[model samples]
Target: MLITIGIIIGLLIVAYFAFVNFYPSFGGDVSKERQSQYTDSSQFEEGKFKNDKDVPKDPTFSEILSMTRKFFFTKVEKGRPSEELPNHTVDSLSLVSYHGGTRLMWFGHSAFLLQMNGKNILIDPMLGEVPAPHPLLGAKRFNEELPIAIEKLPKIDAVLISHDHYDHLDYKSIKSLKNKVNQFYVPLGVGVHLEAWGVPQDKIQELDWWQDTSLEDLRFVCTPAQHFSGRKFSNGQSTLWASWVIQSETESIFFSGDSGYANHFKEIGEAYGPFDFAMLECGQYNKLWPDIHMFPEETAQAGIDLKANVIMPIHWGAFKLALHSWTDPIERVAIKANSLGLPMIAPKIGAMIELNSLLANHQEDWWD
Candidate 1:
């Protein structure tokens, strides 16, 4: 009997190894040579990337068990939307023909396409149907269709990735987008995954926090974010996570990529104040992990700290990663923003946003 139990345990261990190794979505490993380059970064230490603050502390065994129980056993009312979200289909001809000023389009959750200074850039384009290594392991996306198909996208000037989390950095999306993108800008240690996925090493550029790089007239700054990164269970924090500062001479934009509330917003504002627009993460939050993902009110406050001329709440209205109601994030944030007299815009999925119109506080509560 004991031998049979041991055999069962051995088989389980082998299966786990095989799955992680054979699965393309688990991502690639960072070579020792590549990891050595990160030693100079203050955020890199003890062979893994570290946050500025000692946030995201590992939960204890009891805490983990409790969370697991709550997730699998506890029912969350309205955790997902009752109906499919409404979105505007992107006109491919318009995208190709329009030579207007800077514009933006949200592709639900943390994905966006930005046209600035004659360049087309994609930010954290996780357009996959599921935010998991395998589709069966995750819930379906709220929106069944993307505004534009990945194949329909025009030639891309650059792709900016915030981190390697599955929800933010999807493998299928990258495979579809890579051939068309001229450059990929990712946080330190993240390029290895792209390189492993057949992206040429030369086409990828990796940056440490506060590091700045430019393509033509545009400046891309890899700024700080209070978050963690991992694609699989064993490799947490092996890579870095970040917010981004994108700037043309005329427009400045900030994208807070999956961050908790932190003083980094004020620091970013001080260094690069009065941004033309900012996209702040405002969802998938719970009290269990307060330090990693901000509550909704914190999202509004983050806008004030960034000194943004206008702010849009993102990271919600798409997936059910947390226990809150589907609309809780935007609802709470809008109230706080109104009380603070901060201009906030909450466009529907796939809505085209003219940068100039943001100053007039363009908003759509389409979730209602």
Candidate 2:
């Protein structure tokens, strides 16, 4: 009986390894050369990337079991919209042809198509229906359709990725977008996954935190974010996570990619303050992971920290990644932003936003 039990344990270990290794969605391993590249980054140490601020402490076996019980058994109220969300079709022609001013379009959540300085750039373009590796493993996206289908998109000049989480760095979306995109800019060690998915090494440029690179006249700076990274259970923090600072000759913008409340926002603001617009994560938060994802009020404060003239709450209105009500994030954030006299635009999923006219396009309470 003891020998049989030992054999079962051995089989289970083999199965776990096989699933993570063989699964394409789990992403690729960082090569030794790539690991060597990370050695210079202050954030990379002991063979994994890290946040400078404190993150959640590792849970004990009992604590893990308790959280697992709550996750599987607890009933969350209004976790998703009761009906399909209203959305607008993408004006692909205008998007492709326009060079008059910098325009932005949110494809729900953190995904965006930023047209600036006569160039088309995609930021965290996770257009997949489910955020998980498999369709059955995650909830369906609230909106049934994207503003513009992947096939309908025009040639992309560049793509900016913040991290390698499945929700942020989707495999199917990358596969569909790889050919259309001219270049991919990702955080350190994230290129391994893109390369594994068939993107050419030459097309992928990886940067450490505070690193800056340019595409034509526009500037892209990889900034810090207080978050962890991992697609599989075993490989947590193997890659780096970051926010981004995008600047054109005329306008500067910030994208806060899944960060908790930290001084990094203030630091970024001081280094590159007075942004024209800011898109910040404002959803999928809970007390269980408070160190990683900020609450609604914190999102408002982050906008202030960035010294942004206009802010839009993102990382919500798409997926039910947290137990909060579907509209809780926007509702709570609106109150905080209003009290702070901060200008925020909460547009519909596919609404076109002209950066210069943000105040005029102040979105109504559509989520209500």
Best by TM-score: 1
lDDT by residue (tens digit), candidate 1, 1-368: 99999999999999989999999988898777878899999999887898889988988999999998887677888888888888889988788877899999999999999999888999999999999899988888998999999999999999999999989999999999999999999999999889878899999999998999999999999999999988877888999999999998888999999899989999999998789899999999999999889899999999999999889999997788888988999999999999989989988788788898875535657788
> lDDT by residue for model 2 over 69-103, one digit each (tens)?
87667788988899988798987787777877888
lDDT of 1: 0.91
Model 1 scores worst on lDDT over the 10 consecutive residues at 358-367
My TM-score estimates for the predictions, one after another, are: 0.97, 0.96
Please give the lDDT score for candidate 2. 0.91
Error of 1 at 95 (Å): 1.0
Worst 10 contiguous positions by lDDT, candidate 2: 50-59
Question: Model 2: what TM-score?
Answer: 0.96
lDDT, each prediction: 0.91, 0.91
